[model samples]
Target: MILRRALWEGLLSLVEDAEDVPWILLGDYNAVIDNSEVCGRAADTSASMTEFRDFVTAAGLVHLPFKGCPYTWHNSSEGSRSLWKRLDRVLVNEAWLGAWPQSSYLSALPRTSDHSPLVVLGIVGAQEAKPFRFDNFLARQASFLQSVASVWRHPIHGTLMYGVVCKLKNLKSVFRSKRKEKGDLASNVRQAKEFLATAQALHEQHKEDIFLVLVKCCRMVYCAAVKMENMMLHQRAKLSWLKHGDQSSKVFFRKINSRRARQRVYQIYNSEGECLTEMHKVTDEFISVFQTLLGGVRRRRTIDLSWLRSDANYVLSTGEGECLILPVTEEEIKEAFFDISEESAPGPDGYTSLFYKAAWPVIGRDVCEAVKEFFVSGRLLKQINATTLTLIPKVQMPSQVSDYRPISCCNVIYKAITKVMVKRLQQVLHLIVDQSQNAFVPEIIADNIY
Candidate 1:
């Protein structure tokens, strides 16, 4: 155990030295992370599990999600004496995930040995361009609101949604120009530091009033540069708050890179099981699967709900149901906006809740009227409700579109509309939900259902 602990520490040191590049550790360590990885009557694995978990966590490695045989090793004993365990697996670092977000492994059946063979499941292709994403730090700028307001002043002759859409569209160019002006944050910090150092050097030699003023001005500029750089890093890294003592910029960049890498769809498998790297072909595969699944023909299977209806004792009254149909109030609209996290992912609009919250006072009337107009007229612009579908790999090596989970990122206004409706729905849920089904009900502990 002592020798193993020492080896873990040694490996940790090595990993830290080359943390910039993609790395993975794969082997049969003859130890399992938990009791689930072991089967049959074996000695207490508590100490071993703790040690292995500690090493993996401290080393900042993650288990590569795999498919195929769960038990990689067999004891090769008869009946009751037979034992199985997953002794072989793969572990990866953030750089590896950043390099191949779709990467996984397969545990093939053992042929000659008791241990199963493992194979890395992934294919690398050319990188694609990323769409524009709003930087959270930009919203904090003093000129941000002014820039937005300047463009928004233009009158767009259309529906309320169209007007808001046009205004947002104009603001995009403004924000882009702002980002270009900001340039590279890291470079800015470097230049600022260089200027400050020169000022300090001259100040030491002269010690005159002019040099003293120059040093202070340079110092202030350097501090501002550092603040902007750190803010940009924090937003990209998606950290809620940064610790004052820890100021590692590389960590933040790595997180942002890893997230971007993971979201890129490099390739997919066709029905014939051939790997495809072409982007258009992959797009067609996704469209075909989703179209068929969502609007496809199905078996004429009818479910028997007569027994359930008869046994059900809970149902909403007319007044209770009327509450749900009541018109959404402005308070509900504001509450929904406040409920969403400022840093949460944005849709095609490239605008997050932060923009809505920060600029509420300026655009509040326009937004409220827009939302209210939708409910009154029963019409909403497609752009306002446009969604961005992000695919997440479900299996070790997702070949087909079905193997990937699709998450839809809807526009904030559209989300806010639904959120207000959900708030109303939540109030009446307890009236209709059975006492036995505890999940999602107010004041009902889900564990009690167990």
Candidate 2:
């Protein structure tokens, strides 16, 4: 099944449809081009090899030079384990070949895998070594003076020694003064001019040949010193980058880990159906922890408290199908519904539905019961206040609501039922009123305020 011709053709078609790119295809071919390409004894008419060779030719690909490690595959049969074939190859497209005229492809000896790895190198415009030049050097005063002194003492064997020595002494003094101020190209040039003038004077008083010799000697010393300085500068820069390599690596991995972690969280939060139950089970602890983090989720700054009842209606939409509840507004169901639709894989139900079909009716009933309880409790509280009028004529109201005991066992029942019912009411009020959004107690009171 793995070696079927259709599978090979399908793979090739996939590559052909990819975005235009300069690609170098590399991997074990598992088939030979010719009898010579195979290492172990083989039959001349191997069907797989014949198909592979034809495919390469059809694709207009050329095998590159295989050097150093010739055979790419080996036999693992215990009886006669031997090197067995060169089936691996690297095939580059025309664009790649055009870009790298000098490229060479080769196969390496197999290591862990039965198939050897194919490698490519020396693709056109490969880097070449450049000869060092004196002009590229840079140095400070101290080094420049030292180089001058060495040249003077050495005298290049046969060059004029007397003039070179006089130039060296003048340059040494100039460098010492320049070093005190600061060393730079401007200062170096100034020192060179002064030394040249002194040498010219000495030559005029002595011999013309000596003047020319001293001029040449000074220029050569300056060039050598400058080159040495540049080399040192280059080394310092490279060393700095090498020292910070670990820091750069840490930054790279940090970004990758952060991105992957956020993606996982989003995937969980946006899932639905049985997956949502799983997501809640897995991420509820994290959400609870996040809730502890102050200001993690922001409340809308400007809430439309005036239009809350109307806005709430827009949010509550009727369910459409088996998974959907009938009474809840369509928009209210969208959140749960859409969440399930976007996961990489379907939820536990193996279907992508926005709302949990079986669960929606239950959720809808809960919302309706809660809203009704809020109004009922609010009405009961008003009735109790009216009844207190005759009995409280000689009595004074308590200083605080907490000081008042529940009227009776029935009063306690009202409080318990109202408290449980207000949870959604608190959420709804929070969404509508800007002031009440972060204040849960106000919403709880508002739910029963009527």
Candidate 3:
């Protein structure tokens, strides 16, 4: 008979849920086989052992076989007063039994203790070791060589450029087979030879300075572009703040009630009017504080933020987190606004106002003129200094003198010449805009400010 009842409160619980995995419960039961299992046993009919058995049964556990020594506990009394007991047992469910039919249980006797050692035996599959490849060992050495070569080269260009050139050359075979002048590969090879010759000439004149200069200029331009992007991000964040900053004020005045509900409705209007006046003062304080922060302005006079938070709703919602929703009291509002005004009181650096300093310069002439016109119309600033400054890297320090390079340097010089020619075109456009600011305002600078 299965006698199921609570034992030790909720101590011995059953496992009702099972995941997709083989499970086995093999451990000592600390129970007896029966009353005959021990001669000097006390209360063999106790409910403790029955409760454990019921838990095992409810959990769908299957008891396994006992091999050599079944008795797990023995009383070591003098002579004929000794008794042996089966205190340990093994239990596993049907899932493990069906999965591994050859698996068996081993129960060994205790040497110096009462509990016995239990072991689960099964015929598990063998796993084979993978074979080593000579190419793998060579691959590691090749990677090490590649890393060392890259480090020695110092700012090495990636092999991807060669791959791109090769793909472009492949187009000669792909689109036009053996054409002479217009063939892609033929033209590319000719251009490559010319580049090599120019590089050789540049090397002969100046060894490394020209290349270093160009690289430094490129990096500087890249950094400037990055800075411009950061400024835009800051502007975006400020705009977003302007849009959502008034939400707290909206939350403040959502609930309103009369000061005295019992008085005649029309006669009690005076006190209600006073309450509303107090509320407006609170709202005004909120706006003044926020606007002052955005304006980056400071005042010598004290400003109270609490005069606006008059309603019980305002007081209750003033607490932190969700739990502190008790309407803010008049004292609380005074304390909060006092702290704000004290912290907000003026200081010296008033000249460093956000209003005066523009974050970036107007790049082109038309943009610059438009900006100047806007400020002039608004009476913000009298004049702005729009000077043409070339954006070059801080490194490289512009050089007027030529240096020696290998005969191969001519190829590099030719490339540099092409770049310089492009720069000259840009300079011409800039000069024309600066000279004829009124005419170029709509077309030139409007196309490119960045």
lDDT scores for all predictions? 0.79, 0.43, 0.36
TM-score of each: 0.68, 0.26, 0.24
Candidate 3 on 69-94: residue-level lDDT in tens? 65666767656676677766666554
Which regions of candidate 1 fall more than 4 Å away from where they truly are? Answer: 64-71, 96-113, 118-122, 176-289, 296-332, 389-408, 420-450
- Those runs of model 2 whose alpha carbons end farther than 4 Å from true positions after fitting are 1-4, 18-20, 77-83, 122-450
Top of the candidates by TM-score: 1
Tell me the deviation in Å of residue 29 in model 2.
Answer: 1.5
Per-residue lDDT of model 2, residues 1-450, tens digit only? 256478569757855675245556777666677777765555436777678766665554545433445667767764445547766777655445445645665456667888877667653333565311112122332354344444334332322322322333344344345434445643465576577777767777887896879977876655544444333333323223333223322233223322222222211222232223233454563444334642356577687767885656334323312222124343443333433321122211121121123223433333233334444444333221121101111212122212223222122113323344444354445444554344455535555443
Candidate 3 TM-score, C-alpha based: 0.24
RMSD of each: 6.4, 34.6, 35.8
Candidate 2 total steric clashes: 14
